[model samples]
Target: MINRISAVFLFLFFTLNASFAQQVLTFKGELAPIGDRVEILTDSNSTMSLRSALSSKEFKRSSGSQFPNLGTTPYSYWIRFTLKNESNSKAMGIQLTQSMMDYVDFYQVQGDSVTRTNFTGHRRPFNNRFVKHQTYIYQVPIIKGESQTIYLKVKSGKQLTLPIYVGSIEEVVENAMIIDLLFGIYLGIIMVMLLYNLFIYFSIRDITYLYYVSYLGIVMLTQASMQGYIFRFILPAYPEIADMFIYISTSLIGIAAIEFSKHFLSSKQYTPLLHRISYIFWALYGIQISLAIAGFHNFSYTMMLALAMVSAVYVLYMAVVIMLKGFRPAKFFLIAWTGFIFCVIIYVLKDFDLIFHYNNITNFTLLIGSAFEAIMLSFALADKINILKVEKEQSQLETLKALQENERIIKEQNVVLEARVIERTSELHEANEELNSTLENLKQTQSQLVESEKMASLGQLTAGIAHEINNPINFVTSNINPLKRDIDILLAALDEIEIVGLSDSTISAKQLRIKEYKEELDFDYLKVEINQLVKGINEGASRTAEIVKGLRVFSRLDEDDLKKADINQCLDSTMIIANNQLNNNIKVIMEYGELPLVECYAGKLNQVFLNIIINGIHAIHTKFGSTSGGELKIATYADEENVFINIYDNGIGMGPETQKKIFEPFFTTKDVGEGTGLGMSIAYNTIKKHKGQISVMSSPGEGSQFSLQIPIHNNQSLSHLN
Candidate 1:
């Protein structure tokens, strides 16, 4: 009785455990997600054999709706299930969707005996499999109403994901063909984007396109490595190399994505701190590459996927940050990466089992996302071309606008110039008419001038004779009466002495009378006075002779060349000629300094001096009105290079407004008709023609000082110098 009870209890316990261990799948000629009726068994050491897994009961059932996503587990994961084929299919197709798993061992069991076994994986040589395909696939024979027990031993250095598909072989191939078609389209898109960007890159020579193109190529290689295309086609003999490329390509794709975005978004310029941090990540990616190459593939793959997730987040973060900072291109970059990042997140979450998962979602997630991202980024590059086009048009428009503005301003100035010319012409016409009328009147009075050139007589002869001879003539007249009076007194004294001498008187008496008469007449004083009178007459005549000499000296004014002359002498001659204008009320102060002879037109310079002195005399007259307190101070000073003359007058000085226009033609402080206003203008021109300058300083209540300077030996272009 005790043996019976123990057997029953053990049997009951085994039944419950077997029923609870896994669910059975009834195949109906359609794809079945392997997770629906699968038991997942794990071994930490990856040393669990098929016999051990079948004997041990340490297994876990999977949720039916999703694949068993065991993220990054390496080696020794076992999945076992039972299948009942109800449809008319001879074979059940088992597809392990992930291609990079190092080994996959499939077993078909018949009532505790191993009927058949197939061994294949990405790490094994390509021909070792019963069926040569990208993913690990197995064909197990089944019949209607008969059940098949299956086992799959999976091992990888990357993520340990068992995304299995159970269906008829025909259905499996159809699904694979569908996948190939999709991959072809994706590859076509990537190649098209590459070519399109390449065209733009050559057209504009933008480095951003190069970075993005290289990124697309690496992304294509990464997907190819992950899908076993590289191992199948490129390096069939090198399974180990094909296995390593997945991690290397994973790490490189991350690095490449970062580099591409860094340039494409202008991250360094817009986000300086983040740009620096990106260099730190570059170093981390270096470590990742080292890990992948050094055969630490499990850690490397885990780190790579984690880093890829983080990298996607980081780049997306940078894009969002720079977009808010008003980077225009970043907005479009954000849109592209947002989609890519979304798919990457889903793909990663599926591996990590963070979200509710499915088998087909994993493969489709990144495909759709990456394709969409690549296409949109291509459109973004196209938009950049459009932006450049718009900017060019804007620049052209701005240039045209500036030209129009300049033309408008020039037109206005031309209009103003035309108006001014018309007004000036009218004024000239009126002045010419007045001049002609005056000429006619002068012609009517021509006989009175006796045909002596009127302008020449007035401008030259009158100016010359009046400025040259008046002083000598005045000297003669001033001394004539005094000389006459002195002579008469001396003659009277001589007569008295002669009478004294002729008288018949004794010698002592005559001597006494002569001495007495000399005392009485003051004859000694008379002698002195006679000598002084003769000296005065001589000086007057000498001055007249000097006047004649100066006329000869000044006659060269008609010559066309310059002459060397003394500036002080020029001033003195002007004063002498202007003597009649001077009265006792006006005191002339000479402050002459030692001066060098200057090369100049003496006649013209003389005229300048006359004009200035005459103006000063008038200024003094205006101030004192024939009184004796007015002063005309003339000063001359020199250096080795040039001579300087200053004429100052304590007169009714001009205001600022008058001084500004003082040298202008037809400008004068004098009442109209009393002055022609041409004197100072002509004087200024003469000074300028000598390569010289003239300036004035004055205030209304103070005084006026006019300074003139000229070089000592300048004989250059006198006309243009003005």
Candidate 2:
């Protein structure tokens, strides 16, 4: 009886093992399709969470190679499949074909416990996936005799099409490579189109190529992001931005496409109503992109869909209108847009679950459609170019005919024109002489005007220098009388001492007489007074010396040729010379850095510094209008190869338009006769002559910065050393 019972137990174990084996799908060299084994449950209300889904017995069994087509629905799907390892391969992975699902959750069930393996989606960061890849790939751990049940929950705003494949790691990698190769081929086509049209645009300066390139590039990027290539490769670190990019890029592509169509077919000329509709679609696209970038993604996506549909209808309408108007380019445009529209319709319908769904086809229909449209549009653009060439040739022929007709008319009137030629020759001679005289006079006047301007500038500088000189000179002149008086008093005291020594007087008498003389002369007061006078003289002399030095630097008498110029010294000299302008309200702040000697024309550079400084002072005064003032900061620094001078001012800054034209001759902000506008222009030229650059940054109400960059070691530096 015991032997019979043991035999029945062994038989039951073998029978169950055989049944499990039959249920498992095995593969050796290729992938195993897991879709056929999938039993799906639809959660219409999304009430079945992952925990409930794992234990739920309400799931319906379905057998197919893919999930049922449920386009753009709110229903959540739970897919159940049993995986078993009947082979020796331990390295196996399962990949879900749909990459753009917003949420995908994978669960592994062992006995009574359910383990949530991964919760990742396209909406989350791409790196958060258990296996970082373009698609959701999960590792399956199944021993040779063990079976594992797995569940995937998918929910998205898009249509649900899940195609599952289980394979070894090597096979999975091979499949990825194949898919990448296809994407590469598609992207290559897009890139070629973009670059080809871009080159055409540059070669011929055609707006059509410009519009086409923009449209193609936007479309390519949109498709790439939508298909997960952009997320996987381009912006993996910024997965949150990827969704926003999709909507924006898609909308922008619509704008570019409409703009391209408007220009390519001359819609404004051929079809006015269609042209206006294109503008409406363009505005709609702009609004969608704006909202998407501003973090209104859901609304943006909804609006984008609406715009895309409207754009498609407009494209078809424009194409028809242009064709009705007998435009040759319209046919290609019509064909290209028709193909694209058909694909978009199918894609949208599939998303809405209103059509039969093929996973790869529905996923890449836009890309495929765009590729077709781009190729056709390229042909259309080429045809348009050819048509323009023919038109140009015809125009040239007509011009030639008109010229030949005029030539015959002239030949017929040649006898009558002989008399007029004689009269016109005399008039030409008089006009030539008058023009010559006027030219000479104008040259002299211009020379005189320039000389007068220079003299006027010199006169103003002289007046300022004279004012600076007069102060110290006046101090010295006024102190001389007091100094002389103190010297006389000291001399008188010395004479009294000598007399006392020479005369026959007692020591007490001598002391009494000397004390009386000292008290009479106020000798102690004279001593202190003399010292103060001497100090005053010394200070006055030093002030005079400083003034002279500043003048010398301003004149640049020692800088006849290129010299090793200290930029900080130049700034100091300029400040000193322009003190009359900056002395009162405008404060000059110098932040000097350790610098190498810069080789430059010192005198011209000084002039540049003076001009900018004076301008800065004027700017401050204008901004404050005698009420308050601002600071002028001058900083000097040097790098390994170049020296930099930065002058910044907190004043009424210039607008962008003014900044752009600041270095242009006769461009100034000062009132009519106050500014020559040549100061900055001349400064720019002088800096450029020394192989340097001058740039300005300014914005109204903020302030302005003028930066000068000059090379530390130039050809002139070497020559000057020699």
Candidate 3:
């Protein structure tokens, strides 16, 4: 009777225990977010024992989000959840969505004993995880009728984001595959953008493209590191390196982005204050990197956040300023950076727990923002060409209007002069002096206008000249600081040697001190650098001299008369002067045949060459642009009758109608002020004075060639009289 009662009691005890424990959260067929059903316990000191945690009833139900925003802390969190196999399957998998946690410990609990199920963390070697993936995945055993209670311990130097999912093996595989495919598509888009921008950079040599590509590349790397792709696929054994790379890439992205903004918006030209602020952000990025290297991650992260905010704001401000000043591309720039700034603000808020935590939003913010910005900015860059085209058209229209007005004024003046002449014919002697003075004043006014127009045309070359000279000067200037530091180091070492000799130390001790000082100074490194510094200075000087020589040759200021000159030399000098205007995309070919020295005004010949070469450059740029290929050919030959010189370009050629009017005064294919409508006319007149002929042969889409035939020597009468 007693045994029967005991057996009945045991049966009741087992039944009650099963009923209480088997209240499980089930994963049907899909991976599920372990939501508020889980219980969370905060171990504020990070020293809670598993026995104490399981025994204590302090765990509270989690909030609704799959991932909690705990901010940055040194505390550990203990999470407990119950799962049962509602399906027929006997196996299931658990996955941790957070990839950046420093230490994660999973345990399976049974009666009075806890067994570690899996361990993973960013601080641990990536290969030590239960499953090799960007996400921490662990296998769990499931029985048809039994329940399992799981416990998790998570702690990190970074913000704590705990998102866990449970699913069948097939479901896990499917989810992973879906994620990888999405990432693949995302990365593929980034790569295509990188390549496209690089191609543009190569085609135009725009510094803006260079900066944008670098910024995008660094941003891609940062996103990849954050998502654990680098740790999973690239450095499985070095999660620490992956973590470090995240901070470093973040810092570099700020720098590149600011540089891109500066160039794209022309901040230096339009917003000087914002441009200076950009430099401050660059310095902040540097400091952030240094802090990361020193292992002050929290400080570095804060710095990174600040740098990003400052840079984004500066870019936006500069874009706004440029747009207000009538820059069309700035409109798109403003929109692109707005998306990026919004993402950054949201992510930062989320990190600090100022906003609700959403796993997908926080994790994918940068990726989404970068992708959107890159695409938008690319469109913006492409739209820049259209803006330039519109501006060019506007300029042409204004020039045409100015020319028409000037012609009307001239015609009115001519009518007045005719009327005055007819009226004054009866008093011819009395009016002669007044007419001469009026004519003289008119000549002076015309000369002043011509000079003003010529100055305006030449002023375009000034910036290019400054750019050419500044490079070599910058090279020299950049080296001076390092050279100075190195020299100071050497001198300090020399003074230390003298102090050692004057000291009362023994010979061996003195020798030891000298050796130590030399090593500390990196004596061998300094020695080599000194030589490099000198070599660099010399090269810089030589480059500067070459630029000066090119300038002198182009000007021909000292030799203005009709002197024996090499036409080939004249062409070379003209090319140097026009080098800044020539499309980098075009190649120039020189073909010179034997020719005698042609006696002509060196300055005038230089002017003719300048006009023709500049025109060739403009034509090539208009046709093939800065992306397509083009060639300009200059060939010189001589026959017994004349010296034949040809300037040709494989560019948009003119038709017979345009060619017929090319040499007429105030006639031009270019914008009115752009050409002065006098270049070719002046060339024709100069050739005529030299007893030479100038002509052009052109057809639509076929290329234009301007040919000049000059006598080996000018007429003695014209030469002497002039």
Candidate 4:
């Protein structure tokens, strides 16, 4: 379909050339005076009398006032010279002369416009004489000087008189045809692009595409109209349509430019103020459109000025903003718009006749601007896509890194947890073994205690029996002593009776009496001895009872469970238990302060205190070499919420490295058999159970201070204490 349309346009263009060719004529002849009228004699011997030709009805002559007043008759005439081959070549070699040269004016018509051929000013002919004959040649060509006749018209006005002649018209229709063909091709490409972009706009509903389509349409139409194609073709039937197309195309171009800028620069994003200015230009474009519709040509030109000025300012502003914003596409846009602005300035200059050349500035501006605009917009689209791709890639990379980091952390935690599990298992096994050993030792001690109790009961029974036996033996001995004394007394009494001489019969009666008295006295003395022996046995039994009471008080075996026990009492008990560890070489300094009863496992606390004190003594003993005296300070104190026990030793302190590992299980500085390495570890655990904290501060060559703060009550109380 397009090919067919192209063929038709080509044919019409050639046909117009043919018509322009046929209308031109060329004239070459001689002017001579024959009697009262001048005669034009051609090379072919054809003579045309000037007066007769002027008298013909086909010729219009001016009145005497219009003719030049010379000293001779002023006669002027013109004729159309039809030429052969007028369409194919430029007319050449024809001439004209003045029979009387005072005043003459010759005008030739070309394409509906006329131009004067007469010389003006001092270059006019010097003599007003009619020579016998004057041969002249014309610069315009005749049509092969064959089939066509030349049209010659001569006119004399003012003070000039002459026999004017003309050559044939030079045909330019071929060149016009070539120019038209080129313009057609250019316009066709632009139209196709416009329509294609319009289709894209419709399909995609993108305003940018729509803007470009409108821009192309307007620019193409404006170029075509400005080049006079509309007058030659589409508007031929309506002559006014030629002028109207110019205005309309101008206004449309303005509207298109504004719309294109708004979209192409993305003015709304970076320069909202310029975007609003674009809207103002858009409103002015509406006015331009209205003026074009009204066929106001001057108003249209004024609109062009306004459009140029405003658009130039706006484009410059947009370029600056784009540059400041670092928009790469604006570089191309700036160059293109600057070129268009220069072209518009040139066009304005030419329109007012300030310049002489044919000004096709609009065509050049639109061509270059559109080309650059298309390229830049393509770059912009590509840039946008690239940015999105980069962002996506970065996002993916970050996500991958996060996932890897999470996995690494999880792996590390798993390793740490695994190690912790192994350590805890080992610790549990060690604790179990210790518990079993302690249980076995407790059983053995219980057995020993039972055996000791049995022995004690036997000893008590034996002592009681021994005491009873001793009491009877003592009683017999006492009785013997008393009898000896009484025997002495009786001998003395017999001596007295003998002196008085009442001998044998009296002695027999006295013997019976003395036997009775001896019996009574013996009984009384035995009772007194028994009482004394019983008193000695009672005193010995009382001493044994006191010893048993002291044993019971010291053991405290009945109160073994956890209880609110005085921390001071626990400290004292622990001190007593650890006395062997603390020899006289280490002075025990007790700074016992007022303390409330603490709820704790008293036995465990005693064990913890014993371990700590024993450790302190060891530290002191190691420092002083078991000989040099050292001081072990022990302190107990209580506040509203917690009881504190602090044991400090003036010993060679440990370094940080040793201190850090001090509480680790199986870490000890003592000899293998002397230290189990469980003391501090067990102390830490027991303190934890009691909801307490322990911390140490020490330096080498300086004493160590170990502080233990346990809650006075339960865990809640400790928390409140903190």
TM-score of each: 0.53, 0.53, 0.52, 0.34
Give the per-residue lDDT of model 3 (tens digit) for 1-722: 33443333232223334325333687555678885578888999989976566566677778777776666766788888888777766778888777778788887654433434566787778877777888778777777766677888998766577777788876776777776787788899899999999998898887778888987888788778877788888887887888888788888787878888888888888888877877777677888889888878767776677677777777787888889998778999999999988888777777776764657766677777888898999999888867877888999999999999999999999999898988788688667878999999987876675555456556867887787778788879988999999999988888999999999999999999999999998899999999998888888889889888767766667875667888887788777777777747788899999888888776776777777777788888889877767889999999886899899998899998999899886788887557677667667777888888999998888789999988887667454211
Model 4 vs truth, CA RMSD: 28.3
TM-score of 2: 0.53
Model 1 lDDT at residue 27: 90
Q: Global lDDT of each model? A: 0.79, 0.77, 0.78, 0.56
- Model 3, stretches more than 4 Å misplaced? 1-23, 111-116, 392-722
- CA lDDT for candidate 1: 0.79
- In model 1, the clashing pairs are 467-577, 585-627, 585-628
lDDT of 3: 0.78
Clashing pairs in 2: 71-353
| Predicted structure 4: lDDT | 0.56
Task: State residue 62's C-alpha deviation in candidate 4, in Å.
Answer: 25
Go through the candidates in order and give the clash count of each. Answer: 3, 1, 0, 35
Q: After superposition, how far is residue 429 of candidate 1 from its true place, in Å?
A: 37
What is the C-alpha lDDT profile of model 2 across 650-715, one tens digit per residue?
A: 888999899989998678888887767777877887788788899999889878889999898777
Q: Per-residue lDDT tens digits of candidate 1, residues 69-127?
A: 66676557888888888989988888777788898887776553566677778888887
- Name model 2 segments beyond 4 Å from true: 1-37, 43-47, 62-65, 86-88, 286-306, 418-722
